[model samples]
Target: MKFYTFAKSVAYSILKPLYRIEAIGTENFPKEGGVLLCSNHINNFDPPVVGIMIPRTVYFMAKEELFAVPILGDIIRRCNAFPVKRGMSDRDALRKGLSVLKDGHILGIFPEGTRSKTGELGKGLAGVGFFALRSNAQVVPCAVIGPYKAFRKLKVVYGKPMQMDELRKAKASPEEVTDLIMAEIQKLITEYR
Candidate 1:
């Protein structure tokens, strides 16, 4: 009946067996309220994997190019993913994200905007951190351990919520918050990997 239910069903039906999945700490997710899902970006399908795996609707900021593909774009739109420019801040994207949190849904973000070609975790972009601060939402630090494929048994581990106050200090720049989130996420991913 809900949009998320349809999206989840379709995504699971289509993707679950497409890649082997090993997920943990999903219980760490709160039963209600606005929450930020901060995760490392390694594979192209990481967003969908994380989004569909959760029972709650998790809206993510999709890189604009993903929308350029016809069929994939349609699916993404149906899943409630909004477009975001990689290098520049897209105000419209931010507004959509802000509204999603205001609506009390999960906001999924790959702090590193791009997929890691080298498979090396890079620094995070500030969007997730700043958004959490603005929304006063709980930040759920998650990691998807490598190689989204059947044989690998891809791992997804979600740790406990990170303190929002970590980003609330007077001198905290967006970049610092970004690094903190990335480091925390990277640490989890490293261990999982």
Candidate 2:
């Protein structure tokens, strides 16, 4: 926790200037309490870019293979990263992430389930809606604009938190809820693109 606290501060300090960062709709974030930050993934660096950019410590669900790289894995683990089995439900990963939110910590998930290689936005997976309904934690939609191009800047745009009350009142079926979350994720990402 101490390491993340320090790293987060240093990271934001450097990145805010380096990347010309701007966080839109930041007020959507509840100043305190757990939050589920769902973002569109486009680059391998997206996690750290968002991680170091956000003011809070965001526990990211990274692939298990990343944790296999000896010392780098140890550093990532210390920075509050957990491994998810690639190309699967990764039930254990989801459970652990939910557990973090239950403890009032921010958790980051890429609902699209993979990176955007085509440079076109894709739909979200069902896991996002499932966890939101179960946790009742606020969801903060986010987007990343541009790539980590050589000598170019990238942007991380934050969207307003989805209204949990509205979601509850909608009395959406499972499919409806999933569709709704995906719609929001898409909206958040489109502006960035």
Candidate 3:
């Protein structure tokens, strides 16, 4: 816990001046229970940038390759990041994410699966929807705007908890749930940008 706080503060100090980062709509975040923090991925810096701003501890699912790097792997692991295989379904990763939510913690996921090279929001994968449907976590859509360039203005907007009751009642497919979450994220980007 101490290390997480220290890392968050250091990250905030470095990122705040560099990106002039601002967080909006944080009040939409629930004070308790499990949460799925879904967002669009633009760069490698997205996870730390968004995680630092949120008051709750965010456990993120990073690409499995990152966990193989010598120093970075250990650091991210200590900071609550677990590895997930990209380009395929990794049941282990899914179970880890579900366990996090089931334990009433925040799990951060980039629904697009990977970073976008063109700085546009990509289509969200169904994995996030699967997590939302299987767990009791509240799915929250977020948007990260502006580039990671130094001194540039950037914003992280957290939208309200999605209306999942209807979808759940109807036994919505994972693809359908993903579409709704992605659409909300797009709305945030349009409004905040």
Candidate 4:
């Protein structure tokens, strides 16, 4: 198996025991083509928790700071994660994310841009909507419930993919698209609760 797959398997095996990981609405995932998996960020484990549940190999857009660490950085990179600068419009990161979608791969993103210490969903950054509009990729809204604690029942529930055909044709603003995506994610979280 590829390193990414192997690593994800190992991580999932370890996590499965620590947290009761359950996936809901996984049928909503697209069988192929470029997809943008947008989810709420609760903690560092949110990425791998959601990523491993999905059948596709997700190329996660992680914070650049995580890449500064020694072995942890290498592990995430080997698992198909790339860095994105936080708190600014990082063009390099944008291009890299678009490229992932353009290659018909799954690109995982946290629209909130950062983890919420309170576990309350925060406002989504416009970058996610920008990428959705720019790449016209399928946007799958996901919710990672109970990620902040171990031995808890952690759930990753996916909502239906949002079609951007009309929105794209109208040239919707990034903020508008982001709001819509966040709304869907919120709904998933509410339902999962």
Candidate 5:
């Protein structure tokens, strides 16, 4: 098996038993092609948890600083994570993300830009919307509930792909697209609750 698949297997073996991870609407995930998996971030484990539930290998953006860590950096890099400089445009990171989509790979993103300390959904950054529109990839909204505590059930719900035809045709502004995507994510969160 590939390193990521093997690592995910190991992680699932450990995390599933402790958190009772339950995934719903997994069928909503596209079986192939480029896809953007957008979700809310609650903690450091969010990316791996979401990646583990999805059937495809997910290439996610991590903070540039994380890539500087000793052994942990090597692990995340091997898992297909690229670094993004937080709090700035970081065009290089954006280009790398687009390249992943162009190569027909899944790109996982947390639209909120950072973890919500209160576990509440927050405003999405415009970068995600820009990526979705530029790449012309379908976006799957995901909601991750409860993995906040060990030994507690963690729920992940994947919503249907957001329809972008109308918006794309209308040449919607970045802000407008971001708002719509955020609203869809909010709906998924509500559904989980």
Candidate 6:
């Protein structure tokens, strides 16, 4: 927790000046309990930026490849990141993610599954939806908008926690839930961008 706070402060000190970072709609974020922050992926920086901006310790499922890098892997590991295999269902990763949320910590997911090369929001994958339902965590749609040029304004918008009672009653499929979450992210991007 100390390391996370230190890293967040350091990241903010550097990034705020260079990116002109702006975090909006943060009031929509809940102060307690488990939260699933689903956002559109734009770049490698998206995870850290979102992690630092939010007022909670966000444990992310990083790509397995990132864990192979010597220094980066260690750094991210200390930052509460664990590895996840892309393009296939990795049960171990899912279990780890669930454990984090079950312990009442926030989990951050880039629902698009990978970074957008063109800075546009993409279709979300069902993994996030699965987590939302299984963990019963508050699912909050988030948007990170940036071209990431130095001194350029960048925004991270957190939308209200989704009402999942209806979806839960309807017994929604993971894919269907993901679609709604992605649409909400798109809405945030449209409204805030």
Candidate 6: deviation at residue 22, Å? 0.8
In order, candidate lDDTs are 0.81, 0.77, 0.93, 0.91, 0.89, 0.89
Q: The CA-based lDDT of model 6 is what?
A: 0.89
| Candidate 3 residue spans exceeding 4 A from truth | none
Greater TM-score among 3 and 6 belongs to 3
* TM-score computed on alpha carbons, candidate 5: 0.97
TM-score of 6: 0.97
| Clash totals, every prediction | 0, 0, 0, 0, 0, 0
lDDT of 5 at 3: 87
Best-matching candidate per TM-score: 3
Query: How much does each candidate deviate from the true structure in C-alpha RMSD?
Result: 1.8, 2.3, 0.8, 1.1, 1.1, 0.9
> Stretches of candidate 4 above 4 Å error?
none
* Candidate 1 similarity to native, TM-score: 0.91
Which ten residues in a row are the worst by lDDT in model 2? 146-155
lDDT per residue for candidate 5 within 34-112, as digits (tens), equals: 8888998998988888999877899999999999999999999999999999999999999999999888899999989
- The digit string of per-residue lDDT tens for model 3 on 1-193 reads 7788888999999998899999999999999999999999998889999899888999999999999999999989989999999999999999999999999999999999999999889999999999989888999999999978899899999999986777888999999999989999999999999
Q: TM-score for each prediction? A: 0.91, 0.86, 0.98, 0.96, 0.97, 0.97
User: Which pairs clash in model 3?
Assistant: none
Q: Which stretches of candidate 5 lie over 4 Å from their true place?
A: none
**Can you write out model 6's per-residue Cα lDDT over 1-193, one digit (the tens) per residue?**
7887888889888887888989998999989988999989987888888888877889998999999999988888888899999999999999999998888889999998899988888888999889988887899999998778999999988999997778888999999999999999999999888
For candidate 1, give the lDDT of residue 29: 84
lDDT of 2 by residue, 51-155 (tens): 776667789888899899999798789889999887778889889988988888888888877898886668777777767776768888778777566436677
Candidate 2: where are CA atoms >4 Å away? 13-18, 166-175
lDDT tens digits, residues 28-87, model 4? 999899999999998778888888887889999988998999999999999989999888
